[model samples]
Structure formats: C-alpha cells, structure tokens
Target chain A: MMTALLVMIGLALLLGIVLGYSALKFKVEGDPLVDKIDAILPQTQCGQCGFPGCKPYATAIAHGEADINQCPPGGEPGMRALADLLGVEPKPLNAECGTPKPKSVAVIVENLCIGCTLCIQACPVDAILGAAKQMHTVIASECTGCELCLPPCPVDCISMVPIPEKVDNWKWRYPVIEIKSLAV
Target chain B: MSLFKFHGGVHPPEHKLKSTAAPIRSVTMPLRLVLPLRQHVGNVAKLMVAVGDHVLKGQLLAAPDGMISAAVHAPTSGTIAAIEERLIPHASGLPDLCITLNADGEDRWGDHQPLDYQAQEKSAVLDALRLAGVVGLGGATFPSHVKLRADDAHPVLTLIINGAECEPYITCDDLLMRERALEIVRGIEIMQYLLGAKHAIIGIEDNKPEAAAAMRLACSQNSISITVATVPTLYPGGGAKQLIKVLTGLEVPSGKLPTTIGVQCFNVATAYTVHRFIDHGEPVISRVVTVTGRVAQPGNYEVPLGMEIFDLVQAAGGTADDSNGLVMGGPMMGFNLPSGHVPVVKGTNCIIASAPALFAPQPPAMPCIRCARCAEVCPVNLQPQELYWFARADNFEKARSYDLFDCIECGCCSYVCPSRIPLVQYYRYAKSEILASDKARQAANVARERNELRLARIAREKEERAAKHAERAVGARAEAGGDAKQAAIAAAMARAEAQKAEIVPQNVTDLSPLVATEIKAIDARRGKVDDRD
Candidate 1:
C-alpha cells in the first residue's frame, strides 16, 4: 500500500512538471479569441458599438463586457456569424445603436471644404488626403464607409455617398423557391 | 483517334436545322450602333474616341485595358453620338457604359495593313492581333492573343479546335466551318505556329457531318497535318475543357487551365478571325450570328458588332407573332436578353426568339427525392443536390467545400433534376456570394491594415511631438539656469506681449461713411462700458 501511494505521487509530480513546461513553451502572446472576434467584425472602424474602434469592441466582446449584436454596421448577418463562432444565441441588434445602411464612401465637396484638417484627423483609415488650407479628397477605394469624418468637418463638406451597383460589383441574387403550406 | 468522354452530360433537342438551312449572309448595317465597353469577360476596354468624333470602319474605338481584355472596333464609318450608360445584354438587365455611334453610310475602311505574321516577331504579331480586336467567337469572347501566348513551363504539344457547336440552336460555328473551312484551317496553322504545337486536331460533333467534311477537306489541302475527328453529339461537348478531353483524352485538373496540361483549345470561329486579321487585314467588325426560334426566317447572318437585336430579328424576317422573349446564346447556357433593343456583342453567337411554345415556363420546384439524377448529368461531376442544400441554407463555406466553383452552370443538372429544381441557379447564387464575400474580406483586411498603420503613425507623431516639447523644455531650463517655472512664466508673458504688438486693425481705412459713424457710436458706448469697469 505504501509503494502504490508513492508511485501515484511520483507520477502526479512528473505530469505536473510536463504541463508546466508546455504552458511556458506554447504561451500565446495575446487573446486569440479577441483576434478571432475582430476578424469576424466588418472592420469598418465605425464607433456605433459605443467603443473607440472595431478592435476595442472586439476586445470588449471577448471580455464579456459588450454584446455581439451592438454593431449596426455589421448588421444581422455579422451577428449571426459571431453567434456561430462564439457558440451563443443570436439576438436582434440593439435599436439604439443605429440601423444598417447601404455601403457608402465619404465624398468631399472640394470647393466647399474650408481646408479644416478635422476630417483628416477623424478618418480611421487615413483615406482622406489633404494638408492645412488645401482641398481634401477621399480615396474612394480605401474609405471603409465609416461616417466618422462627416460630423467633424466644420463646413460639413464631407458627405457619405452610397456606392452604386455596377456590373463589376454586381452579384447574383438567391433563387426564388415556392414552398406550399401543408396546413391549408 | 481515340476520344475520351467526360463524366456527365445531358442531350437537349437540337433545333439547329432551321438556322442551318441557308448559307451565311450579311445583314444590312443599321443606322445606329451601341457598343458596350464590357462585352468581353475581363476589364472593360478603355475608350479612345470621344463623342462627335468620326470613326471609320475597322477604326479602333476603344483599346484593350488589360491583358485579358479585347479591343472594340468601329463596324463601319460612323460619328460617335454619345458614350454613356445604356442597357446591355446581360443576365442582370443592368445598364453599363456603351458607345453610341451614328452610321455615316459611307461604308469606308480605316487605314489598316495586313499583319505579316510569318516575317514579324511573334510578340509583334500577338500585339497586332490584340490591337485588331480578334476574340473567340464561340460565345466566350476571350481575347485570342492571350490564348495564343506561349508558356515556357508547359510547352503546348497538341492544339484542339472546337467545332462541336454542342449547344442546341447555335449554328454559327457549324456554318462558319462549312463556308470558311479553308480560312479557319489557315488560322489554326497560325495558332499552331504561335503555340509551337507539334500536331493539331479539329473536334466536331458527329451531328455536323458536312462541316466535318469541309474541315477535313481543308485540312487535307494544308501541308501540315491537321486531324478532323468527329466525336459523338452531346450537350456542352464544345466547352474548352470538354473538347480538350475528347481530343486528347486528358482531363484538365479542377480549377487549373488546359495550358497546364500541355493542351490548348480554341473555338473554330476564333481561328477564322485570326486568319482574317493576319491575312486579310480585317478586324473583328462582324460575326456570324444564328437568329432562330419563333422567327419567320431562321438563318445565320454576319451581323455588325453593335447592331440592335430588333434589326437583326427584322433581318431574319422578323420574330413570329407569338414570340415572347429573346435569349442570347444557346438554350442550354444562354440568358434571356433584357429586351429586343439590346445590341449584339461579340459573345452574341445566337439569338433565340423564345416563346411560350418553344420554352414552357418551368414548374414550381419540389423537394429533392434523393434519386441522384442531377449527379448523373453534371458534366463537371459535382453534386448539385448537396450544393443546392448548402446554398439554400446560406452555407457558402459548405458549398465551397463541395467544389461549388467547379460547376460550370451548364444547366445539365437542372435539365436532369427529377424534382425540377433550379439547381444551376442555386450554384450560381452560391458561387457569386462566395466571390462577393471574398472580395469583402479582402477589402476588410486592407482597411484593417490601413487603420492599424494610421493608428501607429498617429501614436508615433504624438510621441515625436511630446519628445520635441520635452527637448524644448529641457533647453529652456538649461538656458534659465535657475527656476524652470519662473522662466516659463516669463516666456508666456513675452509671447503675449509679442502677440499684442502684432495686432492690427485692417477695416478702419476701408470703412464706408455710414459704417464709420456706426463704429464711432459703438466705440463711444464701449468707452462708457470701459469707464464703468
């Protein structure tokens, strides 16, 4: 009985040491769950989620501080995707956050722009290009359709223009299938 | 030659005899032509002519924008009316940039010389072909020069000319082979030389015996041996990969190009255009289009590039009274044109005036019985039922895992579905969704990178500004040599004094007499307020 107890104790100690070594060797640098959640987010950098940016919101969600359905720019599809990833039930988006709108890019009314650098400072992606007292133009391709630049513009020269559907960006719609109800 | 068969295909009824009854004829040029820049598959051509500019026949109206794009040429001498968005012959029924040309009725030719391909360098010849706007006329409209480009890794061994014309009611390639077989053979020789292939084979469906005979005769006349092998008639047998498989007995790996297998396939009509461009100095200004179904006189006519479909139907003795809609391309893989007013594009091989009698509306889709009928008819050997389920559930990831992109959307599975499900439509939806999501994901990644970089730059700038202020503070402390706070207060006082000294009034001299009187009254009131302070 004494020998069996000693053997069990010895095995436990060895297993503990191995586990400790593995813990040190394969230590992850940051919260990978936060990164995964951030990847699932649309990365619009819009602060409708009551956070500074998408990454901060992702961090809050990872820490259980923010709900998944708070992002309006992500819309219902993104919430569903997050639910699937995080193993949670999807709830309707919070109506107070804002409603989802079509994708748009900020267009600067060049002549009306008072050369204020506020819009450039407000942009998260550095898509707006201008200097002090110079006309600023938005790089349409790079602008993530974030409306952050609009309110900061003193002259209100920045306007969010919805991107138009063209042949290049056109997508095939879902097929229509009619299902007869059996209850009739 | 021993030909290999693909996995699955369906046999649709051939209504080609009605269009093949007569010889290919040229249609009268319409007064107005509307050419869309995005007729081909790749990037739209860059416009070269402005509105109101006169263009001659064969004049380059737009140049190819990229390697895969093809140039657009003026069909006849015309004045450019407008370059604006107009309805195009597409499944989406959307408007794209189109060039409207008003024909001058002169029927004049632009200054163009035949390309001496044999004497000129191969690259030069390919460039000339690209400039001449020669593209595959077998409905894909892929630039022929891009296909003819030689690759060092996979040296082409056999070149296959697709004469299958497998789709029902599309007789453009068939009639071209019958009438211009010699010229097509010459074009094949040019392609063979360009690709440096050892041998060539012409694969025609057994249904077109006359075309095979003509092609065989033309091949016999040539010094270089060109084999004309007639394969069994099957739907979609003319697809580049399918014809390549039949001619060479090799399967192009899924998602890989035929060139990777040392085999290159070109439509027979594409070869005819090459010959015309290199030998006759003629560009792809017109193509033989088969106008059939519910039409009074069904036949193939050489229609100009941008002629309206209504005029072409009129040229074919007009559509029957019962005609309901018009379809571009064959019944198997074609899409219904938005309207009869859409212009003829390079991909417009055949225009079918479809009616309720010719094509009955499909019945409502029913649940799958799991009979596996769709699997039996899929030419690409993909499981259509599984793809349909995933697509219906919006499970694009699952559908992609099932080789959804490999589906050519040939409609063979839809034709064979026992439940009458629109299986191809589901696959198309899934494929497009996958593509759009992929594009979105890429754009998101780019935005994320840009945002991160901007944040880092802002942080760096903030740190630099702080460092510079710290350095100035340290320098001020060193210069003061005693109390830092006292020196800072003295500097602030000096800065305020300088600002007060630099103040100037610019409106005093320019003020009008009435404004000056109002200013004097305001100044007197301000002096009384200052006295109370």
Candidate 2:
C-alpha cells in the first residue's frame, strides 16, 4: 500500500509539472481586440465614456464589461463599429445616455469676463485653459464637445455651436435598408 | 446546461399587478382623432379624401398602392381638419404626415361582410388583410398581409401565436387574451387558413397562467386544432425566434426565419385583428393599449389609432410627479418618447411613465476583465467581447466577418454588463452608421447611373438631329426641291425645338417611373443582385 501511495504521489507531481510547463509554453500571445478598439476611438483623451482614456475603454470592450455606446464622441458610427467588432446586433442610440448630436465645442463668451476658472476645471479633456479670476477665453481646438464646461459656467456664457461639415469632417452616410433580391 | 440563461436580461420588478388584476376596459374617444399616414410598415397610404370631407369609422380613408402596402381606415366619422405633418410615434422624435379629423361625434361603420374565412381563398383573405391595413401590433409593425403571403415553395406547416408578455410593466397582451380569447382563437384560425398551416400552437409565458387557461378554454369548442403551450418565463420569449423555439423545439437557422422552418408567428392582438378583418371586413384603425405606470387608474384600454397619448394619460388619472422618462412599449426594448404629445401608431404597445427610482441611474463603465458572461448569456453563441473590441477599433470589415447582423439587439448584453455599458445602444449606433454609409454609396451609384443615362440620351439626340439635316440636304440636291427642302429644314428646326422641350418634363417623369413600376423595377433589380453568384 505504501509503495502504491508513493507511486501515485510521484505521478501527481509529475503531471502538475508537465501542466505548468505546457501552460508556460502555450501562452495565447497578445489580444488583437484591444488594439482594434483603441484604433476606432477618436483619441480625444476625454474620459466622457467613464474610461480614463481611449485605451481603457477599448480594453473594457474586449473583456465584455462595457458597452460600445458609452463613448459620446464616437457617436453612432463608433458604436456600430464596436457592435460589429463585438459580433452583436446594433440597436438605436439609448436616449438616456444621449442622442448622436453633431460634433460641437464649447465657445466661451470673451466678454462674460468673470473667469472664476470653473469651466476650466469642468473641462474633461482640458480643452479650456484659463487662470482663476482672470478674463478667460476658450481654446476651441481641444474641446471634446462633452458640454462639461457649460454646467460649471455660472454666467451661462459657454455654448456648443455645431462644427461645420467641412471636407475633413465629412463622412459618407451608411445605407439604411439592406437591398434584398426581388422574388416574384 | 443552466437552461440557456442569457446575459443582459434585466430582472425589472414586475409592476404588472396594477392593471393585470383589472379586466380590459374600453376607453372614451375624445371629440377629435388624428390618424397618421405611415402607421404600418412599407409605403405610407395615399390619402383618398381631401380636407373638410366627411368619413365614417372603419371607412377606407387611404388606399394601398401595392401588394407590400396596407390601406388606412378612418377611426371615426368626422370632418377632415387637416392632412398635415405631426410628430410620429418613434424613438427618434421625428415628424410624419398625419390625417387630422374633427370628430362629428358619430362613431359610424361603413359597408362590410362576414365570411366562412376557411372557404375564402388565401388570396382573397390576403386582400382583406391588405384592405384593412392590418399590421403586427407587437412592436414589429410588419404588414400582416405581406407576412402571410410567403413564396409558393415555402410552405407553412405551423402557425405560432406569440402571447409571451415577458416585458415588465406591459400587460396589454395578457389582458387581451383574458378578455377576448375567443376572438383571438378565431383570428388564429383565420391566420392558419390564410397561411395554409396544418396546426396552430399558442405559446404563452408561464407568468400569465390565467391568460393561458382562458385561451385553452376558448379554443375548446372550436374545430381548429389549437394547442396552448406554456413557455418558461424569459424576457424575450415573445421574440419570433424564441417563441417558435419554445413551442416546437426548432431553431430558426442563422440568417433565416421561422417561416423557413415551416412556422408562421403572429402576435395575439394581430390574430384578433385578423378575425375582425376577415369576418367583418373591418379595417384596422385602432388597437387596445395598456395605459399604466406612475399614474392613478392603470389598466388596459381600447384606444383609437392616432389618439394622443396625453388624452389616455389624463383619462388614467393623469401623470404623477415621478414620471420622468416616458417610454413607449415595455421597459427593456421600449423607446423613450421626447414627450407624451406624440400620437400612438400601430406599433405603440404601452406608454410607461416611470421615474429614475425605477430605472436607476447608470454608473461609469469600467474595463472588462475577460469575463465570458456575455457569451454564456447570448442566445446565439457569439464572442461579444471580441466583437466589441473590433467595433471600437472601427474595423467594420473584420466586424462583418463576425456576423454582426445576426445580433438581435435584445439588450441581453447591456442588461448583464456590470459596467453599465449600453451595449444595445452601441450596436444600434453602429448599424445606423453602417446603414447610413451604405445609403451614401447607393445614392452615389444611383447618381452615376443617372448621369450615364443622360449622356447616352444626349448622344442619341445629337445623332437624330444630324440625320435630319442630312435628309434635308439630300432632298435639296434633287433639282428645284431646294425651296421645299428649306421649308422642311425650318420645320425640322421647329420640331427639334419641340423635342427639346418634350425631353425636359416628359423625360423627368420618365426619370422616376410610376410608384408601382418603380417598386417593380426595384424588385427586379433586387432579383439581379440575388442571382449573382
């Protein structure tokens, strides 16, 4: 009985070592999904989707905890691309999170003057650069259009004007209905 | 094998008892009614009567243009106040054409007849459905007439009646089954005959035992071979695929339908409407709706089509202070209405007025940790995380490879996501975006085709003019016919001018063929595409 027990113990240890070695040998390598998801993101560096940046959001999408609809900047197209990537059926944008509004940036009224720096602090992407108690102006370039600056403006001067459809901003509209063959 | 439990189905507290306990009641129609033009799926009905023209209830207000379309009927006898654009019952608060009527207060019916629906030919029954403008009221809003008219070879063996009111806070179907089970059964028989199905199975969720019992009893005396089977309580059991699966243990193959598996599915209300449509020749103008949630007397009410939702809200003891989000249909798959002012269309199932307390605020989305919960809950086995990652990367080419279209947008993924990610919303956005891009491509293609045709026409005209000039020159060469040739040349010039004038309007009409011909041409084009190897 002692000999049999000893043999069994030895076999178990050997199997464990083999399994450990095999696991080390056969690592599945890096994931391609995270890289793909990260690529689709606008790279605004805004944490509007609750992820710290685009990379974290992409990772969450790969892991399945987050939905592709969380990012407002990506809009409908981004959501659809993510849905397609995730192999899920696409649905309408959840109005609760918000609708797909045109890309807009906050324009602070230069004359509203009392720059308490509240708008700067509220800016998710650090789009606005202003000092405390100084006459502040909006640096339109970095504005992610999350409207975070609008709420903090006690004077209600910051407004989101739509970005014009320029050649650079223009995207082709996708097809609405799938063309099916006519069967008589 | 944990009973195929899917990810992302929310366990919303059933507030069904508010109206479930009460019987179905007929609501009072106000002094006015407004019927929308594009209520059902397919092309909007063409208005038959002009403004100020009087119409009776159940009267054909609009006529169908084609086989795929449905006719619109007047809900009540009234003077046409206006045929104008109004906010349509849609998730995206958009406006659509509507027929406004100042009710003369006389709810009158037009000419109609009853028939042994089985004796009537399938074509005639389909005509009845089309004439009545019958559409699936179970959120799909598909033309009922079109659904029954499947291809010659695709034989329907079983008619599956969907009674799975699995969505929380919606008991309209339940109340309908309990109150008018006989009518529904009769409608089911009509559907069975319409589709030439051998047997009929009514699949009701186990939650509505009372409804199931009532349906069973109603079909007891009927000659139709109707069987009522109780399905396990699941959120989307009401979906066409899920209901058919539960009833027959059959899987509708990917990219196929229940009809392909010899099964035809219809909502319970649609079945009831079918009976009225076939038997009495009454067009579907209105439907029974459940007005409940955050209001005082919440229950099922028979409301007219295009009736203002605010009217019902008022009749149901008005909206309470807590009614923040007013959603149309059930909690899970329903759409949020911009305001309650939007008129009810054929697809409007239920109007819910719930506060944030009921539907809690969403927290920030956290990173996914490679959990396979989404895969486990997916009714269709799909790698959701992988797809999500690809979609986020804007790699649609790779996403298509994953079969994105097969995702049903059932909200199962969104419901179960611990990170509170609106997964379904993302999918919708992606689909719309893809669709929009595809549309742009198609429009471009169409423009290119039109340009090519215009160029060809110009070349042909140029050739014809040159030929006419050559003919005139030849005639002038024949001796003293120079004067006649000159006259002929002048006439030819005049004729050419006339042809040029004709090309503008005549060819413009020729550009877009008659609506029917255009539909036919579109179908023909589709056939060519399908015939492609």
Candidate 2 lDDT over residue span B493-532, tens digit each: 9999999788753333444557658877888999899899
- What does the lDDT read for residue B421 in candidate 1? 88
Candidate 2, residues A66-176: lDDT per residue as tens digits? 777887666787788778777898766655555567767778888885879888766544557779888777667655566767776889988899976532223433213
Predictions' DockQ, in order: 0.65, 0.02
Instruction: List, in order, the clash count of every candidate structure.
Output: 0, 35
Top DockQ model: 1
Model 2: residues with Cα > 4 Å off, grouped in runs = A1-184, B1-12, B461-533
lDDT of 1 by residue, B336-417 (tens): 9989899999999999999999999889988999888888887788888898999999999999999998888889988988
Under CAPRI classification, how is model 2 graded?
incorrect
The candidate that achieves the highest lDDT relative to the unseen native structure: 1
